[model samples]
Target chain A: MSAADDEIAPLPSGLEEARSAFVALCGGVGGAKLASGLQHHLQDRLSLIVNVGDDFDHLGLRICPDIDTVLYTLSSLNDQFRGWGRARETWNFMHALGQFGGDTWFQLGDLDLALHVVRTHRLGSGETLSAITADIAASLSIPARIIPATDDRLRTKVVTPGQTLDFQRYFVEQQCRPRVEALRFEGADRATVSTGAESSFADDTLAGIVICPSNPYLSVDPILAIPRLRQLLRDRSVPAVAVSPIIGGKAIKGPTTKIMQELGVACTAASIAKHYEGLVDGLIIDEADAEEAEGTSLPTLVTKTLMVDPRSRNELASRTLEFIQRLGGARRIGPQ
Target chain B: MSAADDEIAPLPSGLEEARSAFVALCGGVGGAKLASGLQHHLQDRLSLIVNVGDDFDHLGLRICPDIDTVLYTLSSLNDQFRGWGRARETWNFMHALGQFGGDTWFQLGDLDLALHVVRTHRLGSGETLSAITADIAASLSIPARIIPATDDRLRTKVVTPGQTLDFQRYFVEQQCRPRVEALRFEGADRATVSTGAESSFADDTLAGIVICPSNPYLSVDPILAIPRLRQLLRDRSVPAVAVSPIIGGKAIKGPTTKIMQELGVACTAASIAKHYEGLVDGLIIDEADAEEAEGTSLPTLVTKTLMVDPRSRNELASRTLEFIQRLGGARRIGPQ
Candidate 1:
């Protein structure tokens, strides 16, 4: 059990009564899937600290893609077919924008444009991203607390062999084709963690922390790059675990594996576990990567991690929570 | 015939070659209708100086309603049924905006939003509204030069019995329900006419100027409120005529007659003509207001000024041009 639980009373035996609340750190899409599952499993007890490194200003609108994904996913408005944006989304905005000779590389769907417009207005009016996100999530009737890692500016830049490009320029405009040499989170060095996120992390009732299956180099690291935020995660008093974004030496979506390969890192669950070395107590891997777990010294849980449907998402969430409970009860153990 | 035509060569006997180029100052909707007719009739010879007083920063978007109307109407993309915005527009943005608890009072259509997005971005990047408007009109393949009255800020404000309100607040939000007492064009005193509009006005090839059938106080006055703009119109060498916004003691649309009555003026074509006594060389009135014309001192053109369709719009435009040509040849004349 967590140190706080041990101090309070005997640890609850059942999964549902393990702890009162937890925090989940994640990026867009893949992370949103697990965030959705976590919300279903924990309801209002889950607080999502979404990566804002992917946030960018386009056409004067501040677009927070990761926050929107988590919001759409948790609110059940996410398009399962396209795996992004709201369901029944229209592309007429981008279509018309194209007619006006606007940049259509990063498509802004009609319904999706609304969020960006409102968010931009709010941000321009002195509302912090954290407050705006909370307001939006609440308006969407999402029970979970969706918080940005920080409210201050912290944009990700992908450093390629030839030049440095903004996250979206590299990801969307160039289709992630550039050979990545390194990555930088501008403004993160002096940035402070969002008040809501800081409070949520320090909450005495926090059960565990889940570093969702998001890209470590791009998504997760930006949040980690913030000094205080990284410090909090590194010195967590509860059992913290991570779900591997990589499975069978390839990502389920996006360019995670390619980035890892470009960084000259081994494409294995053990390698991912090593990357998270001291921060996470254990790593959850797909059954496809179960063989690779033998080489890791950290505790690991092997399961069907490809959450293609709601059922799979729920099942994986349950398995992840149960694993956290086991690790909480018996400190960090050797690899299974 | 226009004096410029006499200088170059004998004026052609037909409506097509009566004058080379003319300037049209207008607002939204009603003004746009006649502007459309003028564009079809004059082709590249028509330069529209649309009123920017109605322009406002709404939710971080620089919305120029009159400019958009002129653009959409000229391109035949205007929604004839709805009387505003682009044809076949979608409300997915507003729908999602409402879901996000954003202000849905000002409805932004999916297709119409493209202009605002691009305009806002360009404005943020220090591009003048005039330059951006020209670029947009050119991209839309509109032959006529569409220009804002001035690039500097000039917002309309309405004074009610209770308090003052911004133009959009009085016009759109209040539905023009407030009892108007006075009106002001904020920042107009310091505003300068846009370069293209100024050049078009001073062009030696100028035929005449058509002050469109838009609300005199709300639309036309804002353009006139600018000191230099008004001075230029007053001292113009060519015929300058205005089509009466009021017909049969009532405005064809909006609150022109209501505002007139509220401001202690008679709701008649005579009152409208008198309003521009020292400004316009002549006035065009609907045949229904023939009696009201007898009271005006300026040269008056009696015609079916109610342009309910394209046929009527084009017919009125042809008649207006013919009248301007006659006045251009003979100079200002007594009422007939």
Candidate 2:
């Protein structure tokens, strides 16, 4: 109803039998919520293309925050109250690290340190991040496929007022205090799109692709910055939709709106739609931003997109899938 | 009473005030026990030259078992029951690592892992092992210095039936299951002795050096393997003595007896004394091996060398210092 376009097509019938598999593009926390929700409804049929842009080495341990968040979310091991890291986590490692004068701003939990140690060891032994992630997911008994955007180095560097900082340093260490001048995805130009991620789009029974409610520039854009991934999404034939991270001129979490404002862009769902302009067939906005959605020409789904709990997450995921099926079954919807 | 040499020189005047500093060559556990005893009496006057032969990277963690044991023992944080790692330790990290199918054979406690993480990170940042160890020791407020034998990769390799296994693999992972074979310190010929370790011997107030009751072939010899260290000990004017690791024709701990037997050497204090024939001026024997002292040409001290308690350790340490003083201050004791 928020869409300005009057010629919007209705959803196709038989969604249960026709659609069997789909991919979800996700960041940590917020996106992981939707990804977890999708996994809840789609079960093993879901593939999460997790952002590895925030990956960095801390104290010689390879930390992939976004991938871990998604994995923890899907496996139901993530702390719902804390909104990060493993549930029932201990801080003995962090306490000890602090005693040794080590940098403690990142806050690596004791239980979570095991994954990093294993990952750093395996990566040092020449195992691909994709392979290790897949193996870890399987070990956790997570049926859904969790894939990184790339096994290669494609770090997201945030250029602030005076200096550029690594994604984790900017976000976790500095607490995003620095005013962002710009964002750059290092190594993204030459980095290869993960095979699993690319093939997810080529699946014959692919229902659609859902860009989870993650920061457009910070999380999702880095994955899209890879030329191969960018080109594939541009030329793909499947219906793709994005759930807006911004709600009521403010981000639900993190510095999404602050970054958006710093970048000289309006912090609104209309801007989010414009940010994904040609890539997505539809945009899902929160009920709070329904009135502002009329400014965009893209088809829109107005609902309570702030996925506060499992029920809300599932409801949002179901609605997004229904919207994707409505545009066209396993086919891209042309721009109005 | 144990020494046959009646010409053994008496202590120099101002013995307590003049002789303020000394060094102790130590390995883990038993050596640390004696080192702790020495520390109890000497306070800040002791410097522990710990063996680095057992140090190895497990799961990318630069694990220095001997140095850690000495540090933990001295700091009173060592788990007396387990004879390793920090007290009040948790195994959440190890359990998680096991869940991920990682190498969990080498136990890394949650609290202990912080040390490895910090060490590995600093090492990766190009900080020398000695500098890091010093920093860690300072942070822990340990009065006595705990110096590794070398900063270089001087690993102890065990030559088994047809293959060479790294020290930790031969010891911890394999639990010393491999049949006795020759032991070699890889990189020993090229490795430079740690500066602090070398300087500890050169102290002007250097009362003497005590070779703690560690394995002769497996532990003590590795420190002696470095040509420079061996030469330093040989040319030193200070009195040097070794407390026997073997008592009652058997090693008190570890695989000393097994390894000695495999090397075709008798597991006796006499064989142990012969092992350090020229390096040590005197040998301290346990009451059980008091009769074996007659077989050695060197001056000997017979006492309860099994430092089972703090009181016993303090007594043994006081006796060793008194014996060193009696050998004539600032002059090497010639062979009897």
Candidate 3:
């Protein structure tokens, strides 16, 4: 599609009714896509509570992979081909860093380095990640709120067949080469849900919670691992739903299916429903996986969730909103 | 002069001289110019022992302004117009930092951020600034050794008319507008000279110490303030000579004269000589200030110290070497 054509596209009609407040638990690329789609449909009604376990300090800058991906994708600044970072990026800084024998496993572009630099500066100056993310997203003119799951430092570690590796090492550097044995969130036990997450839970206008199609073991679990987070979600009266990341026994992107298979679980929508068993009241599976959704105890809806183009994204977002409304939830779209 | 013509200029005779070891005490811009000239003239023989009192953490990156300037200048990569940082630089990172409400007075360039990133990473990994500098300089094809005077944190504070401010605050943010009352090196008394400095002092074939024409108050004093540094220079049999940063009651660059006046000094070449009276065995003054040479206690040599062009730089470097030889010092030239 031409750039100009994409810019002036009209909003989907489903978004007109998606006025209810939402808190989404998200990962990086896969999750970012869904989060972006939801923001397009619901705008300010969406609040993305991103995973901080994927955060790592590389080249002395704190990189929140999932958080930045979500922020960039929502702001329409993300590089489409790369799935992360900004479009039209330059690597002059990375080339120079390589000359100095610095860590180059995780590539950082010149424009993207500005994000890390600003975030690192704010973190050092004693600002919480939540506050910093809000300020940064606002500067980019992103209408939806983006926040970390918690303010405290939480690292996701994967126990592979050979060794325990940090999230980035396993996901980016190693490219998910090792077979998964287990997973754990290092600081989740002590991490408190950020005030934004807390307020989202307390808000009477909240319609439902949407768990984006992020990696179950590596992404969503970290948010759920926070001691009181799951209990808080359970206490809320609003409907909570999750979209299955796996379709036709394969993940749309990343290592969701790989990790699930390594862990000896059936990689399907049924498995996703079972994984989020107590947390979510509904499940959304792609139409391709409709036959596999019959056995799930929770109410399930089928839609085309591929999101290959803007039309598909808007369509899936509209379908999801309609499903939420069928569950007795009313959307509260924000001011134009 | 055309850039091409500047490159075809003849090398000085002293450029072929080999020496076992050479040491220089340097500051920011003014000192960096002489150090660059020395590096050009002496190449591998030069060892720069830079003062770290001006070093500070800005935006979480350790910024050693003098050391970076000297390194960039010696590598022929310095931004001549800016007087510091790398040439052909971009301000994207600094602009982003300003957008995030960060302290933006320092003007860190995009390419310059790479150095800070690498240095900060290495330092955090337990590498000393000396080792990191060596790595960076070596990568840039710079043959000289660059060492920080001390590894411990030492800060230069200017006691202005009203309050004492950090070196960057006084020099950069406030544009050096504050009247100086006194200047002090905060951690100098407790800082031990780095191993690089001590080894240069103990080298059997050590030549004369060159005090580059950096500001005496802000640039060179911190190096001298380190415990036993002055005594080591005084006890050495080799001639320790200083080049005057001021001529005709004005500094060649920076606030050397203003600072001297604020402290009630005459701001003359003789005053510069007297400032380093016991530390220096000889003083090199500009031909314009030849009238004041007879009044100084130390043996003085008058030469063209202005390094407006490569020829002037080479001439001053050759004359300084000739003066060292005529002072009856040991002949320490040629390949080690």
Candidate 4:
């Protein structure tokens, strides 16, 4: 194995204690980055249960922004400069759309459009998004398994001060300008947790569940909103840890901090912990906020949460696995 | 005015000619070339009615290939190399799609996708294809008015030796390799011709009709298949001429000749002339196929039919106008 692969090797000490799978819940951008980091460490043992709340119909195409972001990021094809979409993307299609007087508010690059096209075609043919996404990720040779939180439609509707708008309209077209009042997953009442995700949780060999650092209300909530998903997570007799999206009262990316304030929540790690309170057994917060971690009820691990480089990601991932091992009551079987 | 424009000006000399409008029925590629030629000469005076038979649900986006081709070609945005879609296009979206195991067979370039996305969105929101097309054309500043044959669903299904497939499947996915036994326009029986086209036909100020050298069955037939459209043409007191797609007993492009033979029709100018016997008042054949014109019952005119360059397109178009004048017809006055 290469030096990079050697560094990415599963913790021998933790593995000897108990071999367990890791399921990460994620959204777009911020979540995707952390998911990529986790995938780097866990490799084939990672199961990504991505949120579909941001999925919306645009120009007759069922566009799953979060799913696509995670998929592209995991495959290392994500446009890091843009922080979303595939690397080396082009906007020629969007330019023509402008010429045609079509809506160009939400820019879809050429490479990015292919995913929407294929997914839309499959969905139109009655194939579930979960199945199609699996095929797409598999085709890309992504070692980690990416699955939708649910097959049923669960649109994230942001109820702002004046009106409720579709997620994209709020996030993309409107540029998240509206003051958030409440957020709701429209189809969550009817949504069942994807069978694959449920199976992962039920599997006896399941190791750990890591909630990737995504927007709590906008990303993670939608996945948890699926009627039985929270119950399943609560019932799972395995270590579940959440990586805090906020550090020092600010979101690492997106409008998470702003939205938190607008919704009358303090933009702090405490707020994040309060949100995922009942679901997680442990919380991974940045070392910068370690001084404030003592007050939290959950078992806390202070680590460098920011994934600025590959080393940082691997270091955080290793610490997270080690913390899970200690919390699971597994005996450490190797040298530190 | 230019010398050629002066000679072909609307209302030439003293002649009690029948009032007719120059209408061209078209599909994509080959049809768009002729349509572009006619538009260049006739300007707003030409009504280019495009076939909607090939429009299909691709990746949940409503893709109207013929209408888009005509629109793109007239606007000078068509990619010459691909013979369809926009010029200066990028395949970033398509390449990304391949990575995701998408149905890359029907390549939707990034720039090309914008049109589909916008059209599909507008269509889903209850906008008619005619209105959307008009908006698109006007945005592109196209001089000629391009209209879809119908606002209702009308798909061309090609019945190959093994099975019947949609037009895109036969033309794109199957690479037109399927030996066509028959072709049917699904939903054509209930489809109504677009109001814009119907109004153009009903207008008493029409000059003369010119059928572009597109495939008679695949392109023109679908337009004629609309209920009351053929009858409307038959009852019109105007000269209607058809420019034969066949040149020296073969199609200039596409499957016209092959489909003709499969359907047990002779793949010749005589056969094309016979197919439009009652509807067309005259027939235009290439100079190379002048020998075959003797057997046709309609008044025949010979000219170089190939439009490889702008000069060739204009020359053919000019000859077609002159033929209409000789047959005792005059161009209409006013903007169209």
lDDT tens string, model 2, B1-336?
A: 112222222323455577568889989999998898787767688988889999999998899999899888888888888889999999899988988898888999999999999999899999999999989988888888888888888899999997899988989988888886799999989989999989998899887889999887778878989999998889877889999997788887788888888899988888988889888889999999999989987889998887666666667777888878776543534442
Candidate 1 segments exceeding 4 Å error: A1-15, A332-336, B1-19, B332-336
Q: Tens-digit lDDT track for model 3 on A206-324?
A: 87788888888888999999977888887767778898887777998888878889899998898899999988878999888999778888889987778776566656666666677
The C-alpha TM-scores of every prediction are 0.94, 0.93, 0.90, 0.90
> Could you tell me how far off, in angstroms, the CA of residue A129 lies in candidate 2 after the best superposition?
1.3
- Across B1-336, the per-residue lDDT of candidate 4 in tens digits comes to 234434433333332253335777777787788787777676777788899999998667788999989988888888877778888777777677677766668878777777788888888789999998988888988978899988999999998887999999999898889898888999999998889899888777676777888889988899889877887778766678888887888887787877888889998788988999788779999988999889898889988888776556666777777787676433243132
For model 3, residues B21-105, the per-residue Cα lDDT tens digits are: 5678998887877787677667778888898988998878899999899888887788888777888887776665665566777
Q: Best-fitting candidate, measured by DockQ?
A: 1
What CAPRI grade goes to candidate 4?
medium
DockQ-better candidate, 2 vs 4: 2
TM-score result, candidate 1: 0.94
Best by lDDT: 1
In model 2, the runs with Cα more than 4 Å from the true position are: A1-13, A329-336, B1-13, B329-336
Residue lDDT tens for model 1, A202-306: 888887899999998899999999999989989898889999998888998898988989999988888889888888999999999989888886899999899
Please give the C-alpha DockQ score of model 1: 0.83
Better of 1 and 4 by lDDT: 1
Model 4 residue runs over 4 Å out of place are A1-12, A330-336, B1-20, B261-267, B329-336
